[model samples]
Target: MEKLNESMAWLAKQDGSLIVGHGPFVESSEPPADGTSFYVQDFALQDAKPWKTPSTVERTTIREMTMRFQNAASISCGWLPLDAAPFSVVFQEVMSSIHSGIFEKTVPVVTETGMADQPAGFAIMAAMTRQPLPLHSYGWIDGDSGFSGATPELLFALDGTCLETMALAGTARSDDREVFAVDEKEIREHEYVAQTLVSKLLDLGNIDRSAREILDLGSIVHFLTHIRLDLQSPRTPDELIRKLHPTPALGPLPRTAETLSLLFEWRNRLGCPKQFGAPFGLLDEGKFDAIVAIRGIWWEKNQVLLPAGCGVIEASRLVNEWRELRLKREAVKRFMLPL
Candidate 1:
């Protein structure tokens, strides 16, 4: 690998190994017949050629990569606090739709912007590589612009005839874990996501849905339910991704075209990054592992964006949802700091 200044992509696997693609990457509409290919797509799944064949690929541990990363100069950026008025408007619209039976749940994002003195790609990449286990570190950097983060939500992992995914929702501060575990409103929000995911995969194969549990990530906690399936037959990566991309966790509960359009309009109005909440993955041979592209930083030159989303249900309170968004953003900020 050359350095963070060049184009590169990476996805960490469940086995504690990181697959890194050293660029210049070649764009492809189909997965490579051999070797590893990094998959990158926008939240709307608009990219037609989402596969990128790296000039070089390497498998390494996070610790090894962290040591090789050169520490860049301290990044100095002034961040603006996100205004709550806009989010409140979107919240009202979402609640109205829910009451009208158009949607059971929907996630709306709030983005905080900042201006850096210089490009921050190297620093952000280095920080993400330092994140500990249970959180998968992923990134794609091209020149002075890119995104990187350590995310806890896995979209899915396919190995031969088996597939693994999880429903990660219902966020709360780590201190409030005990109360959050039994909170009725939070539980309902989580169940909406878990049940929707199961319904989608029921026809695919023999399914195993684990009991809902709490995932504690230092400053924050979320409800987590692991789901597995033994497919009756093989399925293509693209097919599986399209079927599961915007799960209720990151998309509308009743995922219809009209509902998704409304959600996209709200997201655009809020200035959400196109790639946030999208599927970021790596296809190595026949296996694939993808993670939800949340809890990350996106930048172009000196401009930086930190976006966080809160799932809105009929029972969601504006004040509580606002607080939850901030909690999520703060957790991402922690990734930029030394552990």
Candidate 2:
């Protein structure tokens, strides 16, 4: 708490440039009366390391994983990400590959309603998901910095050595950003997070199924839940974060193996466009933090680049998903709206 508070205090004193598009802010005075325009910007770090390597999975291994632990989990996810993602130095290389572009895609969707907002990028890890505020971050350039992001995801983060987390949700600044819901199908979809996490926990030891879902914080409303485990037995917080990382907010839907696997290796990927190419951040430990590279625009002086995408589920309607993702492109629309 002290560490985070101190950081916030220091940020307020800076010029607040390190954060421009999608980072956190201590307190915002008031958005421009002309209203804010939305655009995606993929900012990369000056120098960085790699993300974690994924576990290699084969058909037999996958089946074994399902057979041994599927039924024993109290909070299992339906997603099964293959253990073959870039890990360690490999991921750092992935992050370092920012010059060519951060593999970013931003779409601009302008609707006739709402204040014209943009959620930037969408991440789906297994279950725990959030439409992260693109403007939530901490840093400094020269002697100035501050946070952005309307609905800041981390409601309470005590970064005193061990990181404790609390999230918030379900408020709309305007219709530019779309919120999430956990309907029956969504619960089923989010099972991916639960599944992945539970498997890792089971590997540690006994964790009674005593946890339940609860709201992390409140304003509008979002389906929230909490998972509890005393990893002190033989496991550690480091282990938990390692195995259960790529939180739903930054990856894919819950209950799946990976959120943005090969995120760069999908079909029809070029369908959308890149708003900004450097939306990247480095974490305390060499991993990449989720950046709102989605809802941004790249304009060195007058050139514009936009990134936007939609959630694709088996139940996802192609046209409807397209429309929804379009609505998310409001980050730039904020600039083009009044026109």
Candidate 3:
């Protein structure tokens, strides 16, 4: 607590580039990657941006990160009225796509807009401390446009010749453990996520992973499987990230035009301001790690938007899927929203 408070105190004072370790896109002029020797600028594969592999990185330490936090100018958070109609429309599209055989699995992210009376520092602290999951709190403030959130899904991480990733799907309220544990719809959805990722990984390396298990993260639970990739040859973290990003968890499987159309509809009708799983990358020591920036907050001007998502399949119900999306937001709300 003392360490966190001190970090916050330091953060309230300074300005310029702010990159909080192990979180989504913060302000760092250099390419976004983890550690020295190797760094990747666009790990999230944002549109046409190409991957950058620089020889060196301006190493970010805990003290350096603390200094970056000090750089943010003081500001109050606020909210705006959210139109919930788009979610209904997007939900309908998801069902339509699944039934038409365009997608076996699709994920749609919904945003809840509002304001925060507190400082960005407090929000970051609350998220890191309150969430019991592998949740990592992240934030960035540049002029008036900034975003922050607690993310539990790791896109992929590279440590030497071994690569690590997970297929996270099928979310439910934490208390209803059995529902998530045994529900057929949830189970099939979870399997699709894992199977799709495994097939993608097989093209790049040899796979060694355990069976899926329930990974309970306080307010929410998900079907998760920790994956390890033993490279058949050798591949950079950058190489593996490109192949694995926007997994079925955030977009669609098979990477087909029909499946991607759902995402376009989401952005056009549902008001998804940016890509869901694209936000954060970290290069620490010699190891590199990056996460899908889901289940977090996006801040611009005085407005704050909290976002959450769920995988939709043929068997998914409208009411249950909507409830699952809300529950994912509730997990984030525990920290971002005032008690």
Segments in model 1 whose C-alpha atoms lie over 4 Å from true places: 69-73
**Candidate 2 per-residue C-alpha lDDT over 1-339 given as tens digits, one digit per residue, 9 for 90 to 100:** 101121221100011222122223222222122322111122222222222111221112212322333333122112222122212223333333322344221111221212112221110100011112222432211112112222223311212222222221122224222334434433443354445445555654444442324332222223333334444444332343344434433333332323244433231233223212222232222212223223333221122233444333344334454444444444334422211
Candidate topping TM-score? 1
The lowest-lDDT stretch of 10 consecutive residues in candidate 3 is: 6-15
**284-308 per-residue lDDT for model 1 (tens digits):** 8778999999989999988999999
lDDT of 3 at 188: 91
Point out the higher-scoring one by lDDT: 2 or 3: 3
TM-score of each: 0.97, 0.38, 0.77
Q: Which run of 10 residues does model 2 get worst, by summed lDDT?
A: 121-130
Write down the lDDT of every candidate, Cα atoms only. Answer: 0.90, 0.28, 0.62
Q: Which ten residues in a row are the worst by lDDT in model 1? A: 65-74
- TM-score, cand. 2 vs. native: 0.38
**Winning model by lDDT:** 1
